[model samples]
Target chain A: MNRFASAITAFALAILAMGAAPVAAQQATPAVTLEGLVKLEKTIEENGKQKVVLEEPKVVVPGDKLLFTTRYRNAGTQPVDNFVVTNPVPDAVRVADESALREQVSVDGGKSWGRLADLTVKGEDGNPRPATATDITHIRWTVPVIAPGASGMVEYHAIVR
Target chain B: MKNARTPLVLGALAATAIGSTQASAAGVTAGTLIQNTASASYGSGSATTTVSSNTVTIRVDELLDVAVSALDAGSVTLADTAVLSYRVTNSGNGNEAFAINVSPTVSGNGFDAAVQTIAIDTNDNGIYEPGIDTVITNGGSTAELAPDAAARIFVIVALPGGTADASASQVRVTAQALTGSGTPGTSFAGQGQGGGDAVVGATTANANALGALLASSASVTLTKSFAILDPFGGAKPVPGATVTFTIQAAASGSGTVSDLRVTDVIPAGTTYVANSLTLEGAALSDAADSDAGTASASGIDVAIGALPGGNSRTVTFKTTIN
Candidate 1:
């Protein structure tokens, strides 16, 4: 009888010890943590200082060539991909130098693009013929992608029609 | 056995509860875990845009200016006869269309009679034609002018110089723009629209000679009269008795009288007596009287010069009869 009692008590103690061990192990496991913060820094400065300078200022003449240039900088910490830039020509001016860019002409204010030589509309005769360069008043550029902290440039020309 | 089983189950349940509480506490305290960091920044970049424009203004450089010199003859001055010259020019960036018209202000000015036939020498032919020299009055009441173009009109003036003074008179000239037309080549077009004088004055009598006068004359005439009076009738002479006789003379004329003289002659039968004698209303005590043989006839002469028209003078004398 005495031996059996002692054996039963030892068995209960063993079961309890096993359960406690799993709880202790769970408590001992290190926890993962996450935190976040946002900051901004801004500054501006004058480009140059000169008493007097002679500049022609851009002008659009009837038969003169028109030029446009655009420059952009990443100015951020992340890489940018699939960048695009668009420009619309003034109504009073017409595109003359179509080959200046991977040129695409937009007759309808940039709603769509087509080759400067392929854009066409139905005439009074209901014939589909290529539109004149004078009909193109807008242009757009699509660059596949741009890396972070980097810059890109584009240029084109048009004649005052 | 049931009691023992109950204690064991209670202990197991308590241990499980404590474990769940601890696990919940750890879960609640665990904040957000950060695996990687990302940053995007925008700059305050500046862009400046400028625009420039050019302008051009058009003005009237030269205009047609006309004036009438003068009119003479039996007929009235006509507008058509009053030829006017003008000059037109392109004073602006582009060409423009212009029209001209001349209307009479007063019909008596003989605008119609003087300008019987109107002509425009577009080709300088000196002849009148339909298209070459248009008659704007025939179509509707308007005239046409081309850009930078000039023209002149000749009018006849039916002047009546023979009736009145054969002097010339001035004629007024005015102009206006036709419908839907620009200003004429001449500056006078559309002038005086506010009822004011537009034409400048030109004088023709600036170099004429002065006048002169001829023959003139004047005349004069004279007349004279005399009167005598007796102070007493014919009576025998008595000693110390005195009688008076009066004599008067007057001169009248339209001419000047000078160096006049009067004389009284005593009759031979009369006795010589003397008190005093006066000659020409002047006392003359020193002169001898004709009544006295010792006294000579008393007389005097008066002198005058340059008497004007319608004038007279008088002289008187007195004597005593014995």
Candidate 2:
């Protein structure tokens, strides 16, 4: 009878101890946690002249090429995806060149757009020729994604007629 | 055992509470955040936005004022006794309130003030004396005026009723604002005055002095005439031809001729040879010629350079037509 009682007490004590041990252990060791962060930074630089070139500055009247370059920096801590930037050409100027990233051509003063390949022009033979991407005067870059702290540059050329 | 469990539970709760607070302060949660999100451990921050603009410019316009008039003298025989009538008006912007007065200063042998009665004839009698006045019946007087205002006044004089006419006379008209102010406003007073005069004509001496001053028959014939003679004559050459025209302009009348100019019409079927003309031997290239091709040649300007009582000159021109 004595042995039975002792055995039963021991079993009960072991169960309690097991429960208590788990709780104590949990308190002793710190909980594991995850922290995530997302940050964005931007830098923009204008490339036009400080003072407007009045009368076109008499630059070699026959032909003139003006290059305007704009730089956009993704100075943030996270990646930027599908970034879109737009620039308006002044009334006195016409765009002559576009970046390789151009995807569409806007005919109605850039209010709407169409694919370069889909655009057509009557050839000397009166047949349509597929407009090359180079024929596009405006550009839209779908970076797909820009890694954090990355930068990009877009440049276009203007010819004074 | 119970005490130990209590402490462990409290510690876990405390850590969870602290973490939750930090997350709340960072304004983020496990759920979706409609705007931007940041981690609590990374701390808090802010962002700024900026914009740009352009410059512009502007412009404005201006105003002006001017006028002219005419006067005439009737049958006053004495050189100093000739009076005339004039109507003046303000043909400009704003009001014009002022007084105007006139006087005469004569030199040479033709001045005779005593025989001249410069009176404001208020009555209409064809004569300047008390009973023969005309201006009085015309309702004209000397008074102040506002913009576009008008006034008329008369001058009277005494003369040898017969043919002893007065030669020339110098007349001046001085005007002043009744309110003692100048043009444009009531701040300053307008200085000086403006007016004109006429050259003297040859006078017939008094019957008593005629015999002594006359060597010839004393028969003086005065005539005033103007002509456009072609110095290089021959069929009134083409309108713009470089032709010289002699002006036999003379004031043979008893009085002198002042402010004289001879204007000629290029005739029908003719066009102004632009900028190819001269007057009084001087090239008149700067004169405006707006009537070049018009049927009416209104821009024929020939300044006679002051034709004395008896003087004239020849001018030439050359031009091309459209």
Candidate 3:
């Protein structure tokens, strides 16, 4: 191959790689993940800090408090901003007052989220009642910035109804 | 408000307060798998969809509920007709059929009724009107009862005519979910969806009635006494001995009992002595063609007419113990 033809081939390869930027961006993650757990005073020391002993239990009865954790990692070489993660509470269980962090809850299955006081659940009498700790249906968190290669987790507690 | 969640719910907490429970077939129940996919969008790029690595499914499940409307035992009488009404409700979350079987209470004292029949209260008026209501075909599966709905059952029991006075007998009626009648810890399959529901009722709903003796003020009392006479004219209970059974109907109440008749079925181990029936000290022929009485190998029947209040009439028949 002549120099001119080799130059054209290299340029075509570069264009093709550029066209596949979105697919590669998706595969090579600045990614987020979510987890669910049931905990009650199950504290464990992790890295010199006491936190809930995360468990994957086989059975859970009424009144059990659950902790949901969402971990986000920036694997790609780029700083990400406006990070947000939302989780819908299990329909049969309710959210507790003290969550792992300050978060918003949704009573309408993640359609909209707000403080617990701003939510409502239709009760047995078919009347709208202020959302109690057990009425929360979804939990959400917002992060202003997540640097490259950095990972963090957000969590909340919900009591089984 | 409606939840477009499009899942059937039979959860007791969310529905009825009774022990009945709810089940959903959206592939989620306690102690069942709950898979949630999570994705994120950031850095002005399309969202990255990743199934949860921090994922878990906390145990949850559905419960089966079967209940009777009545909360108390009922009352009936000896030799009288009684009706037991039970409103069997399916408090569960989906539609299902229930099987019904009735019997004298396993641990009760009431003598079993001679004639007991079960009928569905088709009119929902709680009446067991014959010809109007359809029988459950000797206590069988009910026609498709729906969730949150109830079907009324009428158990008509006729106390055996020969029931002893001042006795109590009870009858029990049981209803079982045909789908979940056996084995605990097995899934109760949701009516519409696949697989099993989380929980099921171990036992079905059963209602019982205590047919206690009301101490009938107008009732007549009968006493039976037997005496054996041997070939040697000595009292004996041995086989081939002549046995005399005296049945005395004494009126103690202040009301006359009309249309009174006396019947004696020969004992299994005894052979009837011909022409040996005495009613009120009058001889009654042991012949089916005889006047005012009929006789057969089974026994003898005599028309005793009426016994006034405070009067006593005695009927005696002789048989040979075989």
Candidate 4:
């Protein structure tokens, strides 16, 4: 696949950037962290105009919006190929939007992945129909490669239901 | 020489985009715990490593709401027992108890009805049975009810004696959450189901409805008399003698006396004279027609419609001995 070829090239580039002298091969490893937060919005009037501001949540109720962010960093000295991040959607909330990354969702508990529009689920009438945000059970992103000491973050939105 | 380095920000930006809404009652239950953890896997040539993030948890808060409705129709009779029905529903997202109040006397009413018994539908049936249903003390609180559950109640009252007929009175029933109630967003700490904070919903946690009772008593009275005359201008009861009958009809009471009709069959051995029927000094047709009075083969018929209280009508007709 084109994606695998690019991953191999990135690995070669990381090796050239390091040095040309003989060196021992090192195992690649990346540190990953995830956080969940709620947003509280407030609107105020200023100079005959309305302005909206967001604050950290003191308490959360039903119908509130939440953000889930996952960050990954390549802490090893060697380049990493085929780096993948997977997150399971919590049962108390429904996915509201996709992240600003190359993302795919799985309706069958992380067994498969594809664009939401390309997926199908069993409907109440016992027929297969287009999958909706409520049917999404997992989300994943596959990066071709992570250069040594490189890092990035991906985030998505969900509604408490 | 040193290799190139990349740095990713540690904290998220302050701004976040919002999304569509879902109803509170249909959402996650109060005090529910939501947990999430994400994992990542990476590999180079011939080696792979997997790592997981720290778990995050969130607790859902409680929403309090209620609704009440009156089940009885418009009115009840004076000096009689009147049973009014109501239904109270817990519309919140947690188990809740409610206090019910039924006020028999309302402002701007003609007369007050005395409350006799307040009862709950123990069997969950919509009807109220005196001995079988549980009686509630006035202004008592109900047992804990689950979310979306409802309770039917009955308030029996007696209309006071000597109350004017056709007069009306109003009764009010109200239900309030037993934990607490106030403006929306008011909260009671550690009082919700599963020990989460309980907050008043858009309904303000309480509701009330009204029912009406009216008095009615109507009556109608009738009297009759007869006189006879011979052909030679002498009073006698003989063959071919004419007998004149007079009848009076009166309506009394506070309610409408509707469709008051007066009819008399011709006695045997007598024949009704042609064109002799009269009502209120007006001549009536012998044929069955539009006039209030009609002399048919069966009898003399008169139709007096909707006679109000203290009103009366008169009718007279002649018959000859056969």
Report the C-alpha lDDT of model 4 over A1-161, residue by residue, as the tens digit: 22443454356435533532222134222333334344444456999999966656445556666776777777767778888877777666667765412368887767778998888877657789888786667788788888878888766676666
Scoring only the A-chain of each prediction against the true A-chain gives TM-scores of 0.57, 0.45, 0.63, 0.68
Worst lDDT run of 10 residues, candidate 4 chain B, spans B8-17
The DockQ leader among the candidates is: 4
Best by TM-score: 4
Write one digit per residue (lDDT tens) for candidate 1, span A1-161: 32443354356446645744664464342111112221111122447643422223121112324344555555444444444444444332345655423476665545668887667654447787676665554565555544555676655554322
lDDT of 3 by residue, B1-322 (tens): 1231322221211211111223232212323323222334455354433333443544444334466553225454434566767677765434556787776654666466643678888888777799888788655877766555778877776655545455666555667765664453345444321233534533322322233322122357789899999888889778889998899988765334667788879999989888888887788887665466776678989777766668988988889988
Task: State how far residue A132 of model 2 sits from its true place (Å).
Answer: 50
Model 3 lDDT per residue over A68-140, tens place: 5666777656676777666655455555677612567666555667887777777667788786664555577
DockQ of 3: 0.12
Single out the weakest 10-residue window by summed lDDT for candidate 3 chain B.
Answer: B10-19
Off by more than 4 A, model 2? A1-161, B1-70, B73-82, B106-109, B112-141, B159-166, B181-186, B189-322
Find the 10 residues in a row with the least total lDDT in model 2 chain A: A32-41
**Interface RMSD values, listed in order for every candidate:** 39.2, 33.9, 17.3, 15.2
Per-candidate clash tally:
27, 20, 14, 1
**Residue A89 alpha-carbon offset, candidate 3, angstroms:** 4.0
- In terms of lDDT, which candidate is stronger, 1 or 3? 3
**Candidate structures ordered by TM-score, highest first:** 4, 3, 1, 2
Pairs that collide, model 4:
A161-B28
**What DockQ do the predictions score, one after another?**
0.01, 0.01, 0.12, 0.18
Error of 2 at A105 (Å): 36
